[model samples]
Target: MGGTGTTGTTRRISRSTTAALAVTGLVTPLTLALGAAPAQAAPACTAGTGPYQKKVEKFLGRPVDGRQSTADCRAIKAFQTKHGITPNAGYAGSVTWGVMDLMTKQKAVGTNPNRDGRCPVNKGRVACVNLTLQLSWIQDGRTLVYGPVPVRTGRNGDETRTGAKKIYWRNIDHYSTLYNVPMPYAQFFDGGQAFHQASVSMWNPPGSRGCVNMTKTAAKKYWSLLRNGDDVHIWGRKPGT
Candidate 1:
């Protein structure tokens, strides 16, 4: 089974009029000809400056004015919408900025995520999970084989256990009896915690139970690159967990 995604409804907006309306916190109602069906007005983008306005502007590659603008609001809203953030009102609040900060760190990992040498490089074909960055990758004796793909680890109390382990079992279509959720391409490592494909957004807040949640593509690749008895080294504490 593949991961699930959400589809959003698109609305037609008159750019010139919408921009003006958004600035004044007014609704931009859709204009229709006679006898035409009425359509819902698009949600007005936020116009007030946020706490992290400057940071958000910098991240979005917009002018660092620290003030909200129509272009900036659209860019931030697009990012929030893509990442499944709620409201997505183009406000540069802590939540939106937090996600952006995580992205910045994830990007910094770059092509050499294991440069810190924290994950065991001596082990042949090891799957390394860095909970701090919420990233996972496959390596064969210091040589990178797969990714530093984004992942969602266990949340707060049910944190994913840290330490070295081995892939003891694998189930292509595993069902979590405890949580009653589908765990596709599951590879068990520590206790009930495993690496599996997640049905929800990886960027969703709070995170998983104890399982290492991955995107469908990442989970499938991990399945192909790893197998039973392969080394699995996990370390670091997940941020906010």
Candidate 2:
């Protein structure tokens, strides 16, 4: 309902933090603040260096229980190796950890992206893609998230989905319908979905199907700026401009 704000995560991502939760229950929020950092220098969530991977290692120690953590990446590799589970390549995501949680623990990773604000992208039918719909809360001005975000996209051959409902639905990802997202998290064009990162020229193309796609960075930031009951409107190419 406003502009973009800021905040911080890890279901797991990159070659950093490797602290994994016990496979006994559900995931608790921000419990990996173990070894801990001083405060100020605790690292911004969007500081990169593998995203949540680096930060988690800064706080969590070498090994929790018996898992080994070289850095911030969740101990996916080690755990996978020891327990006979398939080791991860280098990338870490919600689904990765979500699966780990299921095999090791019966917990579901918390969706820290839940927010209390709304995405502000109302440009009156200019034909933009609604890529990421994360926690892009607006503070002032025309600020955009410029960070990680969450969203749902089109399916089948007709990716241009149309509807007006508040749903925290999860079905797409970089592996799914996600193709690309906007950069700098600039929320423009309608109901907070004007993020066009790579392939900038292809945006609003005759074939995009109206769903916003982005790199992990922009997606996560978008999530940190939102809350509940936020109005989200996504429209592009509805005929006659």
Candidate 3:
């Protein structure tokens, strides 16, 4: 087997664009073409605003006081780490804000699944994964048990499969036979593609080899809520897929 790179979700923002956004206000849409990809470093907390803060809170499914407090940073860091954001520094920086903004926008446009339609009829316990937004939710019948949690799916050459399946097996501490990396709380649904916990980058050049990677916290909650043979429905194409 070959050495696979660590997984992450990074955007290609040019330095010139970053500088220009600082001048014209980061809210303005960029007209300049994006240049080469750079390191997934976060910008300073210079673009704070009520709207941005509100959006962050909304995406996190919680109420933020518009202060970006320590708790808020922790939440943001978790989200970043889950989605493969670099640094995972817990700041609402440009990359973090960008992904949140895009997710909200996608929801508004009806591209992602609605909260109302997250689970199937009469399904007691199920996991719904939206690849487009890299978000997941667990539902028991009509009640949302957990999530809208950030996740990182297979990337490019290793794209995760979408559709219905069941968790046929589980492992609290598992190692990938292919990559030899830790896959905590693994719930195997599709062959070689389980719902597991793994470290992520915001924009790492490498993605998972068909698994749905989530944060340790989210994965633990999933392990607790899900048992073998529970339904798992994965759908939607990732943004730019």
| Tens digits of per-residue lDDT for model 2, 109-226 | 1332223223233522122123232112222223332322222233235443444433232211211113233233233233322333223212112223334543334333343333
TM-score of 1: 0.77
Residue 179 lDDT in candidate 3: 75
lDDT of 3 at 233: 90
Runs in model 2 deviating more than 4 A are 1-159, 170-174, 177-204, 215-217, 227-229, 236-241
Better of 2 and 3 by TM-score: 3
Query: Who is ahead in lDDT, 1 or 2?
Result: 1
lDDT of 3 by residue, 68-177 (tens): 76666666666665556666666666667777665554345332344557457477888988777666777677766665566667767667788889988877666664
CA lDDT, every model vs. true structure: 0.75, 0.29, 0.62
| Ranked candidates (TM-score, high to low) | 1, 3, 2
**Model 1 residue 214 lDDT score:** 84
